[model samples]
Target: MAALRKKPRSPFWFACFTLPDGRRVQRSTKETTRKAAQAKADGWEKLSKERAKARQAHRVIADIYKSAHNKELPDATPRAFITAWLTRRQGELAPASYAAYSGRATHFLSWLEAAADGPMADLETRHFTAYRDALAARVSASTANHGIKLLRVILEDARRDNFIADNPAKDCGLLKQETDTARRPFTLVELRSLMGAADEEWRSMLMFGLYTGQRLGDLARLTWANVDLQAGEIHLRTAKTKRFIRVPICTPLMEHIEGLPAGDDPKAPLHPRAATSKQVTVSRQFGELMAVAGLRAAVNHDASKKGRGSRRAVSELSFHSLRHTATSMMKNAGVSPAVVQDIIGHDSAEMNAQYTHIESKTKRDALDKMPNLLKP
Candidate 1:
């Protein structure tokens, strides 16, 4: 099923073989010796014929290479591969983003358990599919979808690096969340109640959420240097999008910032507790505030024993509602969709499917039109 052909101009022998798909192809053996070149050709054809019957097709590749050249191909465990991938990616990703990636990957590995310690080349679609289904049974659909998507990205790198021949997750579709609850922006009445229930620090964070229209993680990580009281604006690069945005500080936010004590170090976080705490911790604290304001029910640890068979309850509102609240108010105030996205950091696909690059003056005017939640 294979033969060696020598080209008049080339120094190497060419292996002509038929692929498993019944198509004939030629590959440069890169060896001038007829004996070595034929071995390589024979290996390629054997791999194609035997790969379909093997669970570890990558291992089959290693076997053929060993027999042909007597050289071992490199390999890694899933845990080792994922860990190395995360380390390499740390320089390119933000702190929150890296943490999120690391956390989801932990769940992925934990799901794999004993199997994760085995060779990464041994991985199959069934392993990932089982993890996805298992995760879907335990967590919310949104969370399950995000986990699988992140796994796909991680494994995609593995494929590019020759860890695997194919990506299993590439074809594994997301779960259909028929029961997904739609998130709505906070009403002014609800904002007033939450404000009344919040402490000084939380109140400040909420104000930033309403005014800047940034995510909680970004707002929580804000520092004094990010705020320019003199310039009447806040400057910070969002963690997720990494977009450097300058949002005009409105009346209420400006008032609140002026009242707070300034820190000598520019890097000193604005909300000390929130900045140092995990996102889930800050989110829990906000949930408590919402409980006090009669916005949501308080969690009962005893009631939380609902196992993997039950899906986590979806809330119509959370701290994220503040982000929606900010966007809603901005759009309601006659600010264009582009201006809203400029503030909210939404992709054009999420908005009017159009983007207009707006100047700071145009953005300032848009913020000025938004309702002042502190007054009346």
Candidate 2:
């Protein structure tokens, strides 16, 4: 039985109830009227009684199973399992990694609910394949492949935990990615033109990119402490790889660094605006700079006609091209592949090969070194 009562000096009514175990619970009904308070109390009492009965039944069944097998079975719907798994992973993974996992899992579960019309335990390989194909149609193949990879990881964990009989995403193949459309290396002429056109901060960043071959994100967040003018080297820990590298400063870069105003704080970013602004904002500003330099055409999208997916098409030449330019120039200048790899901090030979661009002249010169046994 439940009773409705009002606390002294309080307008709202309270619902007081006792469970089958004689545990009393009191909760504010949040109602001022006696009739409404009585109705709420009655509802609470009914819900408590039903819960008590369910618990009692569950305990009786557990006791029987325990007497027979001495084990408790794990039971949860797909949604419940995934939600709990994601919560556990939130503490284990990096912020960015957790966000990616959460987004993909949430989206897939929503789709699963509509497509399978049942718990996640009933999912099959065909369903995952269908989902992958659907995603590939909606987004780029690379993006679709990322979703598939994430789903495979989630299902593999589920299988390991005995939550699911098998991993449906195990056999699901990644969509075939299209040929890479990565940015090309900027020509020497174009590099010179860009440096001439850039303002002070942009010019400094361009020099750093050309000299260090570091990513934009890493260079933008560079601090005064990282620059060792005495040793003529810059020590950087890459943001993506977390690899610490020491790159010797070139004469040009040194001159530029010397020209900048000295800062008292070693922790202060060398380029304040680049460090503070969002990445997209900086990229867009760089695109505008490209337009100003006549390297790329200016784009104007109509506000009224723009759709949600509409975006400015990527320019052939952008800030990232500076990295390629650095790699290519070093190779062209007769620098050994091993030395270039060390300077650029490439982890593997394969990745270094992708960045290296040997000119026709350089290739021909290397060919000339071969013995003239063919002529003999």
Candidate 3:
């Protein structure tokens, strides 16, 4: 019911009424007479009622669509649907992938704020466009583009399940990757300098990276159980790719391993501190090592802070660059392309993208021919 009340010392009556959305608000009728004020209030209330009824009518149309199609319509909001989807993907996606997907999804929900509470079907392309642009402005193009790609995949799954009629993110193309920050393989001289500057564990890690072309995360988490001394191989399932590969233990790596005393527990980490360290921690430590070797300048905290909200400069050399170096050195050694591809390459086949069905002997031959990193 609409009611008329006087404000502080006003002669005019104010009409207080509830909107269709359930918010109570006051509006001045500008009428001093009671009769005129009551009439205006009644008229406003009637209009709000009509609007509420119209909203209900649209809801009925949804029910009608479901009845006509013999299927139930999805009533989940963006938050609800995205949360459930992430829960379902926990087991399906790799740890790194799930972490990334969850982070981006969470970020999207935060960005949406109140809109996240709306129906999943209500999302439009503008939402994705705004999000992509915002992310790009705050982060790097590669990061924003990767998030967009992941969001597209998530929404496409939603569309297939009838949560949405179409994927709004389908049209949001990825940004161009900034090639200036692209990582390059380390030169042999740079590699030698880094090795000389590093401690025992870091030196071993570099050797593994240069010989096996494995990522820093994988190397940091390696245990004795992952090594087969007799078989001359290092068995590991890569953290990011979830690809199980048996990397041949090169002569230099074998020599390095042979000098170390074996541990009783197979589960014991080869590098105790590194095994427990987070990937970023290991990376930062390596960055410090790079500074010591004069391969890169010391990290400046103030400069890094000043660069917030913008893409910070990335060095062309890092621990991961050793993977590129290993690949480059193998090719330069005249190893066959097919053999090199099998050794450090990902399978292009979508279904078996995590599995490489290459011969062990061929990969071993490729590693044997790789120029010795320690000698030169």
Candidate 4:
């Protein structure tokens, strides 16, 4: 049974409940309204009852196991379980993906140590909610959502393994993400400006990006063997999508590639620094270059903000804009949608739609095809 009542010194309602084992508990509902307070009290009561049921179920299972095997079952802390799971699954995930999952799991365990005094079995939905809020406050909503999704997967695994009765993070909703309007295709003027401002190596990289319609990572890892200068084709398998594509080298890109010094090593990366540096570091370096070209504003980081590091204004342009630029340029040139999609290795028509931006001249030309109905 549970009841909601306000304490003498508190403004919010408190839920007073008793477990099936005769243990009593009192927790703040944090609801000022009576109806909300009652709902919170009911939820607490339900959770307490469920936990009691789970304890009984566990005890029965343990007794059976002990009678059959003459040994007690092993239990693990949340931290220990997550560590073991990641170790077993690391080889199954991509290197970058494994790193991201490991990082998020580490952060969650650290937060758990500071916030909760109980083991994995005692974690509730409310704890996950609090963690979600903390992450949202520290980072962008998209990042918080990503962390929440990873946490859900981890907890869901725990439930599947029978370590926890239920996954606390399963019901934790993701934050709403703002539409990405910052990334846009670079205009011809901006492209020319960037190319002029870039050094020889950067200029070659930019040319490759425009011609091949590939990501920075893919372009950076390009080897001399992938570029067939005589055949006028650049062959690559996209890292993210694993889609193999062959693109023709346009006249400008061909000229740029021919001018570059050809090293003896066929396996040498086209852009050494880009291949070695982390993707984020490479993006930041390109952002700085864009700032130098006056195409983007300079990023400023606030030093005094604790936990929240470097608040920089989002830029409308990035190295990824080159991919958009390639798609748009092809569409505007009257290339077929299928051809553009194949060149860019787009998996879906919806994704291709995002890249296509019709020019005003093309729209006008389309409109001109419609005859005036009122003409005599």
Q: Candidate 4 — which residues are off by over 4 angstroms?
A: 1-52, 55-75, 115-118, 180-182, 306-312, 349-376
The model with the greater TM-score, 2 or 4, is: 4
Q: RMSD to the native, candidate 3?
A: 14.6
Clashes of 1: 0
Write one digit per residue (lDDT tens) for candidate 4, span 294-329. Answer: 997766555675423633344668888888887887
Tell me the spans in candidate 1 whose CA falls farther than 4 Å from its real position: 1-57, 60-74, 307-310, 347-361
> Could you tell me how far off, in angstroms, the CA of residue 289 lies in candidate 1 after the best superposition?
2.5
**Residue 35 in model 3: lDDT:** 94
Question: Local error of candidate 4 at 235, Å?
Answer: 1.7
Q: Candidate 4, clashing residue pairs?
A: none
Ranking by TM-score: 1, 3, 4, 2
> Candidates' TM-scores?
0.76, 0.60, 0.71, 0.71
lDDT of 3 at 216: 86
lDDT by residue (tens digit), candidate 1, 24-110: 789999998999998989998888666433436666776776678865554456888888889899998887778889999987888
Q: Which of the predicted structures, 1 or 2, would earn the higher lDDT when compared with the native?
A: 1
Deviation of model 1 at 87, angstroms = 2.1
What total of clashing residue pairs does each candidate reach?
Answer: 0, 0, 0, 0
- lDDT of all the models against the reference? 0.80, 0.72, 0.80, 0.74
